[model samples]
Target: MEAIVPGPDGEGLVETRLRGWVDPASALAAFRFARHAPSAELAPYLDHHWVVTYADLAEPYEQRIVSHPTVNITITDDFRRVAGVIKGGFSYTMRGSGRVLGTRFRPGGFHAFFRAPVHRLTGRFVEIEEMYGGAGAALVAGVLDEGDMGAAIGVVEAFLLSLEPEPDPLAEETAALVSLAEEDVTVTRVDQLAERAGRSVRSLQRLFRDYVGVGPKWVIRRFRLHEAAERIYQGRDLAGLAAELGYTDQAHLTNDFTAVMGMPPSAYARLGLGN
Candidate 1:
């Protein structure tokens, strides 16, 4: 087994709520957030572990979380379940005082545990007990009862250690491919990704459907839009930003952004500026 490592601080792929909300500074002032790296044995199937607490919130804080192409196992005061990939943004309200411990599975990592095509899980969640039986129930209770974050994380780690999922090479490959789409700005199309992966477009699509719970095209477009959102928040020129993000024109980017974000770039920029 390889050594466990700590997750990076303030550099996670998920963007902070401060970018999308107004007067978040006061609400965030009472929040405690941390992400931890998985043990090396679980690294390929797990992205990172996260714990968030807002025990001292004077009022409810609504947090806007950006979407990502990964599944997660989240435990909170209300429920414990495996959540599928969210196609768009979602909000969670933190009230009074509580904490959430989450395990973010890699793009293809959940397949090891699900033993099926991950596409079935998209846009939905499954209760932990449905998959892991009584042990799952005990794990959730133990983690929630533990006051310390380290102890809570340890309970989860021990549960996963018991499962002993076998390594899946395809999951690793799919994760690497998705990482490329996220990191390489030039990878804007399915054909480009197929060429880079040395696979036919159809093969690539199938791979994504089975493991990633989405098509390659969706992944490419999602990452591009993510980049556009950040740039738009930074006050970049829409026309020039569209061209840079591989959009045909500003209108094309606007339509896509409005469809997913429920607002035009200019309106989003206004929100960003107002905050």
Candidate 2:
């Protein structure tokens, strides 16, 4: 698989690290996953472009994906739409041979394209035709018909170029704050994020609700859970890991993990280790 990277004028593909897979090796063996960067003009609004392909096999492979704070536009053999934040783990079964192409919008970036409160899209799916009319449907058909990945990406780039929305300064600022929360494990509280962003707690909440479709606290907790999944896979001590992740204690950590993952950390670790 090619690593995702920035190309001239933001046309290059970037590398992606898969997370929340039940069996990483098995999944990798069963599918081909790749990611590409949006054109420079579209980078502010898009995180990256991703494509997954697999051939028909004896049994359909069931893949479980974790939730993120951003929105996505996905196109498959017969489906197409803009999807909002997935609240929890969801499974997609790969049946007959086919490809699925998707664009993950940066946190808060969809606001520019939607021109409405992003919170309205949370946990919802909007038809592409509703947003882009016949043109959008044509784009989908063109991409599906094109067998070349590069050509398909070009079609998507052209589509975004046609709907270029005015830049949203607040979307950029919100993206910066969300990036901090995702990368810094020490950022465990919304109050801390507010202080860092030079805003009050209520102001931060409103900003996130308007643009990100989720609260600051939810972002922080979700990021920590992502960290937990990784550390548990590496066989880290749950007690120390809990303290490090800013949970009240191990029980609290386990409770949160179980709620989202549908399994305790210990069980997940075993699955990760292929035990």
Candidate 3:
């Protein structure tokens, strides 16, 4: 459930923003390609890692039901070459659809979530038949396959892991923002968050939008909804739960839940815990 986040080395953290992460131990890495495509834009920065599909949609396209900050496992009928940023989280791809396969990461300055066989290590996206255990092991195998950049990969991996996951570096403010929002559903002002993060309101908003693909207010609302959903799914009384979650009333909660989840709380309870 570990994701290897890219560091400020090699490309030196170019603003282009193709974030990918692999577990140091290679527990589970997610390589994601993201661009602001219509269908693609709906998927958000999930708290857990998820794998979704990339394909051509026909006319009368409908937006995906699942909300952002949630994982998606995409399915497509044909092959396609995709371009976008990849980010990782602490979860495995629960299910995959269609005929697509996972691919491996090769030596040539490759940033893979996991290792794959050299022969099958093509650039295009396909399912990886075999997965390497961790970054080090994957690098070693990739080095054996292709002689160049083996040592450099090792050094880079080492350097990335050695760096502290703290301080003002690497947008530490994001952690704070997440913490504050997760604590309660009470609406928070952007200016308040900016003050707490020691950043200007505009800068914080921009950072959240750029990295999370959603504005701060939206993120907060989603978090609140997630909590409400969890409670309702756990057999909590709808009216009481709504009040506890800071909703004005049961009707208020119901409208919001139905809007976001595409179903009422009662239906969700009958279905399952997660959406």
Query: Better model by lDDT, 1 or 2?
Result: 2
lDDT of 3 by residue, 57-128 (tens): 232222222232311222223322221112211222323322222121111112212122212322223321
RMSD of 2: 3.5
Q: Give stretches of model 3 more than 4 Å off.
A: 1-65, 68-170, 183-192, 243-246, 272-275
Best by TM-score: 2
List the RMSD of every prediction in angstroms.
5.0, 3.5, 15.1
Query: If both were scored by lDDT, which would come out higher, candidate 1 or candidate 3?
Result: 1
> 1-275, model 2: which lDDT tens digit per residue?
11343432345454676655555556767777777778898998999988887877678888877778999999897579898887777767898788889999999998988888888888888888887899899988888888888788889879887887778899999999999998999999999999999999999999999999989998899889888887787677666888888898999999999888878988988976773
Per TM-score, what order, best first?
2, 1, 3
Give a tens-digit lDDT track for model 1, residues 71-137: 9999998789988887877767888888889998989998998899999988888899887899999
Locate the minimum summed-lDDT window of 10 residues in model 3: 102-111
lDDT of each: 0.80, 0.83, 0.39
TM-score on alpha carbons, each prediction: 0.87, 0.91, 0.42
lDDT of 1 at 91: 68
Model 2 TM-score is 0.91
